[model samples]
Target chain A: MAASALSPIRIDDPADPRIAGFVSIKERDLTGRQGRFIAEGTVVLRMLAAAHHAGRGLAAEAILLLESRVAGVEAIVREFPAEVPVYVAAAPVFDAIAGFNMHRGVLALGRRDGVSGRDALIASLPASSLVLAACGISNHDNMGSLFRNAAAFGVDAVLMDETSCDPMYRKAIRVSVGSVLTVPFAREGSAASLIERLQHEGFAIWGLSPAGETDIGGIPPAARTALLVGTEGEGLPPAILESVRTARIRQRPGLDSLNVSMAAGIALHQVALINDRI
Target chain B: MAASALSPIRIDDPADPRIAGFVSIKERDLTGRQGRFIAEGTVVLRMLAAAHHAGRGLAAEAILLLESRVAGVEAIVREFPAEVPVYVAAAPVFDAIAGFNMHRGVLALGRRDGVSGRDALIASLPASSLVLAACGISNHDNMGSLFRNAAAFGVDAVLMDETSCDPMYRKAIRVSVGSVLTVPFAREGSAASLIERLQHEGFAIWGLSPAGETDIGGIPPAARTALLVGTEGEGLPPAILESVRTARIRQRPGLDSLNVSMAAGIALHQVALINDRI
Candidate 1:
């Protein structure tokens, strides 16, 4: 293996042009060019590297480590199949540029792919697949957790509706433990239209609504299914509810509803169980 | 009606002793004392007021709000039944005292309840009640989310084993949306002892193990069941697994495991479904 050479670049000034990608952490939408998606801590960095190696297109363009964090970064870099650029800077300078307290002492910048459209996602999935359709879920963490659960429960793809937050958002990626990078996902149109299309394509669209008439267990183990989840305060839109075959995870009378992500996790697991029966 | 008996006192001093409870943000041991729990934001304050109205014994000992945030605080106090003390301080002083940015600009110190031991929790529950037993879950947010799910799914009580984090931590309370305060919970002995006790009390102990032989959906609905959840990285301990009948949430073959909180949510919802069938 020719040592795919990557030199360690030293950054002495916070305003150094090479370190511009790290500034202004608060402004996630900088220049609208899919700004650097940051992954902190060794575990997350290793996951990013692994995804990159597995042809998931998660290659980190640059690795930033504080002077004291060089050892940890070196250990992580040893596992990477490709030699990526490493940047070393003073702790204070790094903190100033990063705009936050650098607890993990290591951060990586990676190019983000454009959000996949619904057609692209549908084309990539098997005929009979378990899918999680997230609609109107605005909380980035919740969105990330839903994707993470989808990955864990073997959902073939995660389809997001128009109102759903971007899965590539920094917080979403961090919360998903980098599963967002590995999992196939795309943004569909409106929830109602998507449900209609899925139903037409022989996908049993089970809206995970609290007010649904059918119990979640009574879904009759379909060959192909999609679990649709809504936001926290408001559940599925009335239009979507009316169009899809509704199912609910039964709960006690007094409790209002489960947290959106929690509900998604339960529904995804149940769907996986039903799929296994087939 | 009574001219709002609780008058707002303005304080500009950061060293004011009246706000000592709000000063130590990072010190957990200090917050364990009575009159130490801090509730931030208007939503939580509203929930606290509602809990107080419901005679749940959550009374704000003192309220602190930034001068600019006076209107929101006043609105909350209007709904508060009791004559709770309200204090108005400069935003900088409030932030200095709270040791962080106060986004909601409002904070309250509530009386902390003595967390019941395992014996007390078991004694209080009905013979056929469902309980959630969490073990070795150290993440505060995850524990909080579990409690929220348990409450939503109508679990009788949430019991934390020896290795679990404290449910009353500030982050846990915030993440739980004050559900931790509403839900019945107790920190108890080892998972083994609790499993034995529940079994002796005619409860079916269902340990959630990823590697278990039985699928969660396969378990026949039981009159009284206790769902056991362990930490995310490590599932149930071997001793706990041996003590209880085990069930696994079926997942994709290659995925490692679901987040413990997500798993707890799914399990609670499934148990609730089982209960509904009976």
Candidate 2:
């Protein structure tokens, strides 16, 4: 099979040992130890290739291509750096290992990077900048969307607190549309500690909570502002809420809150208003 | 088999005539035409029951319960109106018909309703109110979340344009967490026509565009505002943009835009500020 003329090694059997990387995708327990994340669809593969070329240091360990999709896969591979490997297999074998019908017939396994710490991220940003601090958001899709929003809204940095999920999770990466790679992010300490530290650095910490007495419009356009958003179910912890200046996006009377990610987007946009004036 | 103690309708074959409703789910061509949508998991089933009870005139056509979920199903059924049908099936048969593993062990088929029209909705809300007019959003999940935001922010109504996906789609229903039932929404005509009609009704149509010249905060808090949000990609059409007053959520420099749904949430929240002052 290794000596086959095709660039992708063909595996006729679903149970083949060579397809172990694809097989473990459905088995969540193995994901952590394997340290490999899958990227689906052509757009993501292109992103990986771009990231690889830039030496952002993220690269695919291997590529899985369905026989039917080999041509498109070949086009993508042509753009890949010389060191990358591509593997091909029958559709049934690919589907069996993927645990779902493969859309766009391409998947890549890339090694995950350890999250940077708060100081590293702070050092990376300019003196006066806008940052998004995500706290207690466990859902990967929401995390990804938040990152995408952060990038779209020109948030200078994203800081994840203790309770958030891994931004590098496969679902998060996909949902982020690979914006997670382009944006600078780090997992800081707990929300309270981070808020306190940010405040000490002359950053105004505005906690987004419906419980806030101050309207979001009242939040002065600051040179440095960090918008803090909490989890959906339980909002910002009381300690964290108290440690920061609290502001609420005014909502209708019966409605108490917005989805955390959506709330973050709204807040980030509002905070970015000062920058638009320039 | 239909008269058995367990109400078990034994079906040895996938082509069995009695299982037509379940079979139609897997056939893409038959799905929308069949006048039914599948609602899986207990939370969704419970939501269906709530919708049924709210006298909104929506009801589940039937409930399918697998052996393992029978007790939970029975609990839900007990609260359901007497007219709703409940069916119990062996695990394998239920799985076969649904074309997926039934983890929640329960599924409900609900009759589809044609989305309401704009005039009917305007007649329902107070003369002066806040409304969210979703112009061209296509993503079902985003549509659902927008409905949820509308409900949470206490927007008096939601008006979808012709290009928006049906809010009653299964994914939309689930993503809204059933708020679609609580939020009154209707499909309006094209964006330009809707804006014109809304303006005649004394509603201030605030077009939510990232590139708009005015800040969202600058909009007078006392006016009856209709926040218009567009699709993620193309944004609100030019005709629509020219037809109404425009305001943008202020964001930092270099950032492009917020997600449509999130922008809706923020705009809704900001609109609600007038209500708070009153």
For all candidates, the clash counts are: 0, 7
Q: Write down the lDDT of every candidate, Cα atoms only.
A: 0.76, 0.73
Top-DockQ candidate index = 1
Residue runs of model 1 more than 4 Å from their true location after superposition = A1-35, A53-58, A65-83, A87-106, A114-116, A188-202, B1-31, B41-43, B46-59, B63-83, B86-107, B188-202, B220-223
Count of clashes in candidate 2? 7
The residue-by-residue lDDT of candidate 2 on B1-278, one tens digit each, is: 22343343445565666556666454442346454666767767877787777665466777777766766556666667666666766767777777766336777777756545687667666866888898778898899899888877777788888888878776776677667767777875887777777777778888999888777777786547788999886788887788788888765444446668877776776677655532
The recovered share of true contacts, given per candidate in order, is 0.76, 0.63
Pairs of residues at least 3 apart in sequence or in different chains that clash in candidate 2: A8-A88, A250-B269, A252-B153, A255-B152, A269-B250, A272-B251, A272-B252
- The sequence of per-residue lDDT tens digits that candidate 1 reaches over residues B107-133 is 777875554567877878886688898
User: Alpha carbon lDDT of residue A129, candidate 1?
Assistant: 83
Global local distance difference test of model 2: 0.73
Candidate 1 local distance difference test against the native: 0.76
lDDT per residue as tens, model 2, A1-278: 32243466777877777667777464552346345677777767777777666665466777888887777556666677656677777777778877877346788878756545687667667877888987999888799889877877788889888778877777787777777766777775787777767777778888989888677677887778888889877888898887788988765455436678877877776677655522
